[model samples]
Target: MTTATETLLPGTDIVLEQLPKVSLHDHLDGGLRPQTIIDLAAGIGLELPASTAEELGAWFAEKSNSGSLVEYLKTFDITTAVMQTAEGLRRVAHEFVLDLAADGVIWGEIRWAPEQHQQKGLSLDEAVEAVQAGLDDGVAEARADGRTIRVGQLISAMRHADRGLEIAELAVRHRHAGVVGFDIAGAEAGFPAGRMRDAFDHLAQSFFPATVHAGEADGLDSIRGALLDGRALRLGHGVRLAEDIEISTENGTSYARLGELAEWIKDRRICLETSPSSNLQTGAIAQWGDEMVDHPLDLFYQLGFLVTVNTDNRLMSGTTLSRELALVSDAFGYDLDDVLTLQLNAASAAFLSVDDRETLTDAIIAGFEPFLDAEDAR
Candidate 1:
């Protein structure tokens, strides 16, 4: 929590934390509470890198900040180790929603690979059921606490594995239960979306939504594969799609020439789930620069691309949706309107139906109206 003295958004009194937000790219295994990790690891007889919850949290931040993707991903090894059982999965899922609600997330979609959680003899369906149960409990608990929120599962398939079809089926099977969409996570470099074409084809045929992790660890071709083969409705951390645009300046004026791919993305309004802190930690924006200011997010947004803010891995990046919004606003000199635009972008890109999206849009607008009105009076 930030003190009242700390300005979250520069030149404004609006606290980003109080604003209604949507989290489209947060991961389940990557957002565990450190104390929960310690307790779960203890019951499972797993070793931890840090003894105390505070120390463990710091360990994750330190490793993620090491500027190595391998080191950043290694933190997940500790979290996943403790999440092999039904109880572990349910508890984590429950807490994940509570944390989001505290951060003012009205809606969040948590993506995680089910194939990675079957170590303790739980089938994939069982794993999904346990997570859904926890999410349902979380929603009920939040309602009881007077905080309204909804969360859905984006059952992710590991790209390096061959269970894409299986995971896709699992997601569709649970669509009426709690599952809202399908995603392909894990390594994106060598394992392109084409490898999961059958699963994607099945999803397309079933009219299920999909989001693909591309343009983060890999480059343009990976993004191309995600769109063409995976039929992804959204691109997770599609920051590298900026590579396709050519920028030039004349007399202090700039012009951007978009390639056919970039043009299609912008014109069609394909959402780019950009997570600033996590993108920097994973070197996803290294080509642009080392700082948040160098992220292509500002350019993408300015060029009319559908850009949505996200917290890709909350624990690893030590961020919330509010923090990510604040960081981007600070880096790009954005105001409340900019922040709201990003939030609306997320709401529009959510895997819910058009009517549900409109309902969410209305909720977000209603939530922010009071604050915006207050700011106006001041």
Candidate 2:
């Protein structure tokens, strides 16, 4: 990104990337390294929009920042083009984890739709296996490097397609193999979770967790469908759920009146995977404003909703989890305590056993302590 990700903060001396973090909504396909894309494209004889790695990175950033979901999704064509083979998928998954470790992420969930990579005619299960193999390699490599990190797969089903049931079954079939949960992605406007009732029903019967991408291209109705119909434990970029909240001033104090949908989501402690830069780029919060401050992250947190910040598309949005947290912290004038709260929310929502979640929470609390000490000394 020509804008330079280092400019994410103005005067903060501490590099937040080194702080322990948890990533809930990262995508394996959306985060391929620019060099990997170029090399893979060459191997597959696919002509890229930009021949060089630097140029290709710029192309993705520009297209994603265009504020049109269709145009933004076009950038993925280049990434997925080179990721159809087993070798390609494995390498991408391995590197995706390494990048997260370098960014100081202790835990993460990498979501990708296996249905999209079938252009090479690989079966749905094989694709998931390939990615899992890569994730194992990534974990071993990180431990070897003395940087401990863990990641799991969240197999996604394309909402516009009819294979959600199959994909959901694949996720459940591999729950012990590597798959952590199920998600429905792509074109959220016309395709509501209600349309995938059969898939959700089957997943519910299997007792598998689901996260739905709602309130992104659509509004509160879609969010309602995700929670009610899909039984989502987490909302993917559910920023537009803010549409159901009414903020008014009473005696110079702000009070909120939440719609039934928002109230249910908040009362249930449903986690909102809010990605600031991506939300702005995808026009998820366009009705609010053109900047990151316009994001509903602070509002959701203040209203007691389980809000977790994320880097939805690291390559496209040119952001990391730390960058997203810093963006919101600046917008809301938050302290280190606020940052820890966000990470705690993510740790709790992670598709892990209770023991694992407690371990992760402990890690985050320990990691944030030194930063708090630094602030105190100053």
- TM-score per candidate: 0.97, 0.96
Candidate 2 segments exceeding 4 Å error: 1-11
Clashing pairs in 2: none
lDDT (tens digit, per residue) of candidate 2 on 239-313? 999999999998999999999889998998899998889989988899999987788888999999999999989
- Pull out the clashing pairs in model 1: none
* Residue 115 in model 2: lDDT: 92
C-alpha local distance difference test of each model? 0.91, 0.90
Best by lDDT: 1
**lDDT by residue for model 1 (1-378), tens:** 458423366677677767888999999999999999999988978888899999999999998996666568877898999889999999999999999988889999999998999899999999999999899889899889999899999999999899999899999999999999999988788999999999999999999999999999999999999999999889999999999999999999999999988998998889999999999999999998999999999999999899999998999998888888888888899888888889899999999999999999999999889878887888
Model 2: how far residue 67 lies from native, Å = 1.4
lDDT at 289 for candidate 1?
94
The window of 10 residues in a row where model 2 has the poorest summed lDDT is: 1-10
